[model samples]
Target: MPINLLYSPECLEYREAGHPDSPERVATIADFLGQKKAGRFLLPGKCKEEDLFLVHSEEMVERVRENSLPYDPSTPNIRGIYDYALLSCGAAEEACRLAVGGETSFSLLRPPGHHAGSKRAGGFCYFNSMAVAVKKIPGEKRIAILDIDGHHGNGTEEIFREKEGIIYVSVHQFPAFPGTGSVSFANCYNFPVYPGSSSSTYMKKFMNALSVIAGFSPDLLGISAGFDTHRTDPLLDLPLKDSDYYLMGREISSLNLDTFIVLEGGYNVKTVGNACYCFIKGIGKEKHGQETGKRI
Candidate 1:
């Protein structure tokens, strides 16, 4: 199956200069893929307002729309940020749709979600794109969300915590920002690693988490892929090398379950592109059959 990299230059429109989550991150990855002629580039449309209601509250949506100014230090206040956020959500949905259709797709988007919550926004996120994409699909199917961001996906967990049939798993560095996912409970499982943890140690925890996920028999898999755990990343202190992403992708693909990957974090711009390429190549090795509309 041909890998489809879904993105849009319009995403660059909502940029904050010098910020860690800057447009340069996506631009760098997009440029590398373009130069290499890697995956099929696909432009995505904006997300529907009705879909925004799936995970976020009306007050939260209104706040992002009205509170254009930056209230949080990490989340910047860019003009039309709300609109750009909608676009990011739409990109996530597009990636999910393509993957469900039997195409391997990745959403290289910014305002990286996983940190955003029902009524809060931080860690450079606003709408919890992964959560929205999961909610957009019909109910009744078993779904598993594997968040590999350097920081735990507290927001994504919060949205689906009370809900049944969905499992959220996070593998991140402990004693980090938004420090909420310190232990496992209910449908959400968290594997918090210590600083300076090696790639092998991280993989052990990930494999254990996969064992738990496998028991659930999820019909669809969603990966909250984050590369900030790279040893060279400025934000986190994990010893994960570039090649680790390939291994991670290969293991996830080995499950043979329909999966979709959405961008979350990874600040080392120089290596982010390489990491993404490695992951895509690892997962795109085989053609997973097209998933029915019943699952996401």
Candidate 2:
């Protein structure tokens, strides 16, 4: 069973000069995946405004759609950003649909969106795609979201904080951008590692986070996958190697739940591709069957 990959070249249509969240982030992964033949690729469409309302307020949606917000370098209001964000969200929604149907899927698109909140956008993110995707899951299925990004998913935590039947866990660097997720509360669990933490230390925290998620006994799992923890990453100071991602993927695969992954943050173009490929290969080790979920 090949991993179902949700991506679109249109995600490369937006970019900001000198920003860490460049088009190369997704392009590198897509190129590498194609070269490796890692998975079956699928194109995704734009998500509806109603889907944005699943986790964002009407005001926020309109703000993004019409560029009504003030300028912010972290999250610039570029033209056509609303449509780009909607495309990313669409990929996430499609990935969720695949996961619930018992197929492993990964959304490899851009504008990494774990930082955008219900009412605001920041950290190079416009819409809370992961949050929106998780909300699309039907019924009372217990869901667990594990954010492995180097930066904490403050937006995701804010959206699902204390929400019933859903638990959000993050393993990230403290005192980082957005500066949240240092503590755990309600249904949101955070394990913060210090700058320059060894790979062993990071993995310890990651394992602890996984323990929390497993104890929740979730029916479905979502991974806010970010590769910036690599030592080569220009952003933060966590020293994770390439092989560690494979180990992390294997660990998550051991959980054996219906799982979906969404691209979040990974700036190092030189290494992000292989990191993503390794993680996908690790998760693809167990083949269930051909994915039958239709594109959204």
lDDT of 1 by residue, 231-281 (tens): 889999988876787788777877877788899888898998888788776
**Would you list the clashing residue pairs of candidate 1?**
none
- What range of 10 consecutive residues in model 1 has the weakest lDDT sum? 287-296
lDDT of 2 at 248: 91
Clashes of each: 0, 0
Error of 1 at 239 (Å): 1.1
* lDDT of candidate 2 at residue 270, scale 0 to 100: 99
Model 1, which residues run further than 4 Å from truth? 68-70, 288-296
Candidate 1 backbone overlaps, count: 0
Error of 2 at 22 (Å): 0.7
- Assess candidate 1 and give its lDDT: 0.84
Q: Over 4 Å off in model 2, which ranges?
A: 287-296
Tens-digit lDDT track for model 2 on 190-284? 99999988999999999999999889999999999999998899998999888998889878887878999999998899999999998887786
| Root-mean-square deviation (CA) per prediction | 3.6, 3.8
TM-score of each: 0.94, 0.96
